[model samples]
Target: MPDQHSTLRAQRRAETQRLIQAHAVRLFTERGYDATTVTDVAEAAGVSPMTVYRHFPTKEDLVLIDRHGALVAERIAASPAERPLVGRIGGALIDSVAALTGGGHGDDLTADERFLLARLQLMISTPALRAKHLDNHYALQQAIVDALGDDATDPDAAFHVRAAASACLAALHTALVRWAEDDGRTELPELVTKALAAAFGERIVDTPR
Candidate 1:
């Protein structure tokens, strides 16, 4: 019973954190990240400024640390070891996108998904946010390398895994930058799928303009 209660409490805490982040992103998009304040996010989220700080120490964190990246990392870690590493990474990215945006169809996004897309736009367009995102992208690659469980002492394995992770991240970053450039009219999932295919040496029949 105590364990069950603890689980419930943790779940509630996580939900509250998501709520805080979602509201913070919305405010950042609506009012501009520079003009928005933590107090404003707190009020929007119906929490105290201290609580907002507890979840996100800085305004930049509200944009940098996202659940989708963690989910994609977990998917990559869970991929079968026998599979080709780059292909597995690509599949994991698609799976994560489907999970985040309900199949990444882009036909009719849910309210939350729409807001998340908006948040991505804001992050890519804003210089400060873009810098933080690049830092986070490197951190994410390190995380993927760690998840791959390559022996740090084995120079060959370490180099191979690092190279693979770097390429995967590069493809993802390229797709995102292009998507943002097009004003997000193209479905992100489609862009990611195409970019990964090209990265793995598949010929592209249609390129994003």
Candidate 2:
């Protein structure tokens, strides 16, 4: 019963955050990211400014909030332990990218993909957001390193794992930036696989057509 209640609370919190972020994105789109205020987003979301602040402490957070790290971690956990570390991490990243873009091609984007595209465009155009986006990249790198657990404990292993994680993430980032630049006209999963192949010398994983 307690577990169920805790799960319900978490679900409600996530829903509130999603609602607030949706309002923030709409206001940012309509009023320009620089012109929109948190209070305005709060009012539009029908929540107090405090609630918005609780979920997203910084204005940049409103645009940059994402579950990429969690997604990557989940994929890594599901990967076979016997696989090479770099391959596991690289494949996990490709799978996560496929999931993000819904493995579809061209301009037919889902609602979530459209929202993500809008966020990516804002991050690309806004200096502060771009800086924060790089910081988020580091955070994601750390998440991948953490996922390696005991495998990264040795000094050499740690260095290799960190380097590999950074490289794979760079590949994923390149793919995402290209997808946003092309206005979602290219299949994102294919771009991710291609980027990883260019960096790693072969496809990390087979992306479904």
Candidate 3:
């Protein structure tokens, strides 16, 4: 079973975040990302502008977060012990895409398939959102560390876990971005599948399992 607390936290986070993104994206699409103010989105979402600041400290965070990040965090957290680590990650990415596109694992990327793709493009085009995206990658990796077993007898082993987690996340991000450029107009599964293979292949080949 999934950790209810984690699932609830992620649900709340994505709900608040998606609400913010939906509004911000509308404003940005209408007035442009650079032209629109945080106040604009806050007004649209019906929250006080300051309440908007609380949920999104920076305007860019509104663009940076979407349903996908929260889903990825939750999927990895819920993965079972019997699942291969790389398999868990690849599965999580696929699940996150389902949350994004309302589809299955092998579906190719959908171009602005919905507001989700638009939000993704917005983040890519904006430098601030790009940086927040990087921060999120590391944050998710930390959450993965906690999930794996925080009770480490060997401190060095913990560091190794974090390092491996970071590398895996970095690859996922790179693969996703490249997939975006293809605009979901090209073969999407190949890009992500290759990334999955690269990430888990090295470790799997060396491990006994």
- If both were scored by lDDT, which would come out higher, candidate 2 or candidate 3? 2
lDDT of 3 by residue, 1-209 (tens): 47998999889866776687788987886787889998889888887888788888888777765445567768767766576665665666655655556332225434335465566667788777777777777777766666667422368867776776676676667767775665554344445556766767745423332
Candidate 1: lDDT of 52? 83
Candidate 3: lDDT of 112? 36
State the lDDT of candidate 1 residue by residue for 1-209, as single tens digits: 99999999999988988899888888888888899999999999999999888888888888777776687778877877777776766677667766776533254666655766777788887889988887787787777677677533388877887787778778888877776566556777778888888887653212221
Estimate every model's Cα lDDT from 0 to 1: 0.75, 0.85, 0.66
| lDDT for each residue of candidate 2 in 26-144, tens digit (9 for 90 to 100) | 88877889999999999999999999999999999999988889888888877887887778888888778777767555667887888888888888878889988988998888888
Model 1 C-alpha lDDT versus the unseen true structure: 0.75
Please give the range of 10 consecutive residues that has the lowest summed lDDT in model 3.
103-112
Off by more than 4 A, model 1: 104-107, 150-153, 203-209
Task: Please provide TM-scores, in order, for all candidate models, with all chains considered together.
Answer: 0.86, 0.93, 0.71
